[model samples]
Target: MATTEAGIAPRPDQAGLTPLLEVEDLRVEFRTRDGVAKAVNGVSYTLHEGETLAVLGESGSGKSVTAQAIMGILDTPPGFVTGGSVRFRGQDLLALPDDERRAYRGRSIAMIFQDALSALNPVFPVGWQIAEMYRVHEGMSKKDAKNRAIELMEQVHIPAARERAGDYPHQFSGGMRQRIMIAMAIALDPDVLIADEPTTALDVTVQAQIMQLLADLQRERNMGLILITHDLGVVADVADKIEVMYSGRIMEQAPVHDIYASPAHPYTKGLLESIPRVDLKGQELSAIKGLPPNLTNIPAGCEFRPRCPYARDICKEQRPALAEVVPGRFSACHFAQEVLDGDIEPAQQ
Candidate 1:
C-alpha cells in the first residue's frame, strides 16, 4: 500500500476512529469600525477521509469565513475565532501553540483560494512558487524541488510543464493559473484540502474541468475535501454531503441526494429554487428575497425570517436551533417537516 511522505500508511485515528477533521460550535467575529460582525456562528461539521463536504451559500453568508478559520489563515486583529474547537484527528488545532499550529498548515492541511492570481507571486516563476512548498516544508534541495514542481505541473495536466515552469504567473490563462494553484496546494500531500471557490472566475467548461480534477485527486489520495462555493450546480455531482448556510448560520445539513431531493429549511428551499433550470428556459429565475442580514446588527430570532415566505409570527420571536429533523438530516427551521413534505410553498403562492 502507498504511504504518506512520512512513510506511514493513511489510517484511521487509533484513539476512537475519529474523523479526519471536526469543527464544533465554531464562532468567528470581525471587529470592524461599525461593530463586531459575527461572520461564523456555531458552525459544526465533520469530514472523513474520501468525503467531500460542500458548503453552499450566497455572498457574505460566512461560508468562506468558516474555511479560513479551519486553515488558520483568518486575518488577525480584524478576524478572530472567539469560541469552539477545530479538531483534526482528535487533537484540537485551535488549542495548539501558534508555532505548532503553523506546522500543520501545508504539511497536513492545505487550501486553494478563489483568486489564483492574487495568491501566486507575480515576481517569481510559477515553478519556483510551487517549488517553494517542497523547499520550505520538506527542506528538499533546489534541484529536486524544481524537478518535483515540474512533475506536479504535468500531473495537473499543464502542457509542456517543464518548458513552462520558468514562465511568470501572468503568462498563464485563468484556468492554467488555477491548475498551478492546485499543484502548489497538493505538493505537501495534505490529508485535508479546503478549496474556497476554486472555480469562481473560470468559464463553464473550465469550471467542470477544475471540479473534475479536484475529484480525481481526492479519490487518488483519499483526502477529505471541503469545497466552498455559492454555486449549487457545481457541487451537485461531486459533493457527498451538503451544508446550506445563511446569515452566518447553517440552515440545513444532509446527504447530497437528500438536499437535492427535498430541502427541509426555508432558506435552503429558496436557494434550490433559485438554481437556473434548463427545462424552464426563458422563465424568470427565482431568487431569495431581501439581502443577508447585517452581521453586526443581525435581527432578533431567525435571521432568515425576513426573506422566508413561510415565516410565521413564531419565527420572528424564536430562534430555531439546528436540530435533527430525521435520521442523518438536520435543519434549523421550525417547520422543517412541512417544508420537506411540500406542505408550504417557498417564496411563491
Candidate 2:
C-alpha cells in the first residue's frame, strides 16, 4: 500500500500533495412533474490516499447520484445539487467556475462510468477515446497518445493492446470494455477514482478480474477509490472502509471488517444477512422487507422506519442523526448502540 500521509491535490504548478477529499452535507434533488425527489440528503464522507471507500446500497439509493454530483456531471435541467461541499486538498470544487471545474475533473478526479459500452462512443475506436483525454489534457501527439493508450490497455491486462488499439467498443468483450474504461480513468493519474458499478453486467469470473484490476491500480497509484455498488462480496476484500446508504442518507460507516462483524444499523445488518454466507451455504438468503421510501413523500422521521425491523414510536417521531456509536464507526440509527450490542437483528426475511 502507498503512503497514507496527508495529501495535497496534485498540480502542474504547485508542490505538495494531500489525499484528503471530503464531502460535507451533500444534498441533491430532481425536479419532476410529480414532485421534488431527494436523491442525496446530507451525505458526508472523507476519503484519503490509498484508501478504498465502498458505497453499498440498493438501486436508486443515491449511490450513483452522489458520484455524479462529485464528478460535476449531474444534468442541470432537472437534476440539481442543492447544497454540498466537494473539497479536495482544502479546495471546494463546487465553488469553482465551469472551466476550472472541468480542468480538475479529468485531471484531478476521474470516473469510470458503469456502462462502458455506452460511455464510449460507438463510432470512435476505443484507443482514440482513451487518447482523446491526453490530446485534450496533455496536448500529446496523436501517435504518442495512441501509444500511451495501448500501454494503459496493457496495464489493465487487456491482451495485445497494441494490436487491438484500433478496436471499437463493441469489438471487445464486456470485461475488456470495462478495462478500457479503467484505462481512461487512470490515464491522467487522478487523485481520486469513482468507479460506479464497474463490474455491473459481468459474470462472476469477470467481476473478480475487474475488482482485482481496480485493487492493483489503487495500490499502484495510492489512489482514493470510491467504489459504488451493492455487491458486498466485492467490497469485503477490496475496500478499506464501507459506507452503507439507504433512502439517500448514510445509514452506517465503518471499517470493512467492523461492518461485517457487527453492523450498527438495522438496514446494514439486513444487508449483511442477505449476502450468501459460506457457513450457511444452503440456507435461504434474507431480504429487507418493504420498499425504500418515495423521495418526494418520505415518512415523518426515519426514512427506513417503514422497512426497519426494530423501529419504534421514537423512530417515527424524530429523524435520527448520524452519530458515532464507536471510535471510527458512525450510524444514523437511533438505536445504534443497541444494534451493536447484539440487541437487534433484522426480522428474518
Candidate 3:
C-alpha cells in the first residue's frame, strides 16, 4: 500500500501526473414543471489513478447528479448535459457515441450505487448477475463465467460463495447485497470506480468493513475512486482529498488534513464542526443553520450566502469564484483567510 510520512496514501496531484478523470466546467440541468433545476453548475475536478476523491455534501447538493453525468446514465428529456466535458484519459465521455460509451462504462469505468437492494434485480440470482458482468465484458462461456462469479463472491468474503451464488437478492442481508454490488463493480477491474454512498443502510461495523475493502482494492488495482458521501466521518478515514459542496457548488476543496485541521470556507468549517467527535465530550454538536437554497431559484450572490454566518455586503451582492487562497487549497469564500485564522467561529447559539 502507498503511504506518506503521515502514514496516509499519496494523492493524485502529489504524485505528479495528468489526471485519469478530468471534469471541466461541467454543467447539468433538469427541466421541471416548476423551472430549470441547475443540478451541477460549472463544477470541475480531477481524479488520478490510485487516488480517492470524496465529494461531500448534504442531500440535493448535486453530488449524485455529477456522478450520473460522468457515468453517462443521466435520464434525458428532463435532464441534459448543458455544457462542459467529462474527459477520461484524453477522451470526452460526453462526445462519445452511445455504443462507445457503453463499452467504457463497465470495462473502464464502474459504479457501486447507494442502494444495492434496488440496484440488483430481485428476481435474478445474485450469482447470475455477477456472472453476467464477466460474460458481457469478456465473452466467457457459461461454465467459465460461473467459475469467475464464484471466485469474485469468495474474494468479497461472501460466506459459502458456491452455496450462496444461486440465492436470490432477497436471500442476502443488506451488507451481503452491497458486497455483491462491489463484486460486480470490480469484475472488470475498471480504471475508475464511482461509489455513490456505498455505505448507506449499513451498520457501523459493516460500514468500516466495506470501506476497508474499497481501500484494499484501490491499492491493489491503482484505480481512481470518486466516493460521494454526506458523512464526514466516512470520508475522514478513506478520502485523500475532500470537496465540500453546497447548492451545487464546491465551497472548499483541500487535502483531507487541511480540511479537517483548517477549513478555509465557513461552510466547510460548519460541516466539520457538525460532525460529532469523541474529543468534544458533553458539547452540543454545531449544526449549520438554515436550508440549502432552492436550485431553481438560488441566491443572486453566493449560493450559501443565505445560510452563511459571516455573510458580508459583498457576499450578498457578488458570487465568489472557487479561488486558491493557499497553495493546494481552494475556497469559494471572500474571507477564506479570515475563516481559517479562527476569526470566524460558528456564530454563538
The reply for model 2, stretches above 4 Å from the true place, is 1-19, 278-284, 344-349
What is the C-alpha lDDT profile of model 3 across 143-231, one tens digit per residue? Answer: 89999999999999999999999999999988899999999999998999999999978999999899998888888788889999998
Angstrom error at residue 158, model 3:
0.7
Judging by lDDT, tell me the better candidate of 2 and 3. Answer: 3
- What TM-score do all the candidates reach, one by one? 0.94, 0.93, 0.94
Whole-model alpha-carbon lDDT for candidate 3: 0.89
C-alpha positional error of residue 319 in candidate 1 after TM-score superposition, expressed in Å: 0.8
True lDDT of residue 36, candidate 2: 97
The regions of model 1 sitting more than 4 angstroms off are: 1-16, 345-349
lDDT tens readout by residue for model 1, 1-349: 2333322322222344458899999999999999999999999998877778899988889999999999999999899999999999888999999999999999788999899999999999999999999999899999999999999999999999999999999999999999999999999999999999999889999998999999899988988899999888888978888899988899999889889899999888888888788998899998887888999988898989988899888888999999988888899999998998899754443
**Candidate number that wins on TM-score, 1 or 2:** 1
Between 1 and 3, whose TM-score is larger? 3
Identify the superior model by lDDT, candidate 1 or candidate 2. 1
**Global fold similarity of model 2 (TM-score):** 0.93
Question: Which segments of model 3 are wrong by more than 4 Å?
Answer: 1-8, 14-16, 278-283, 344-349
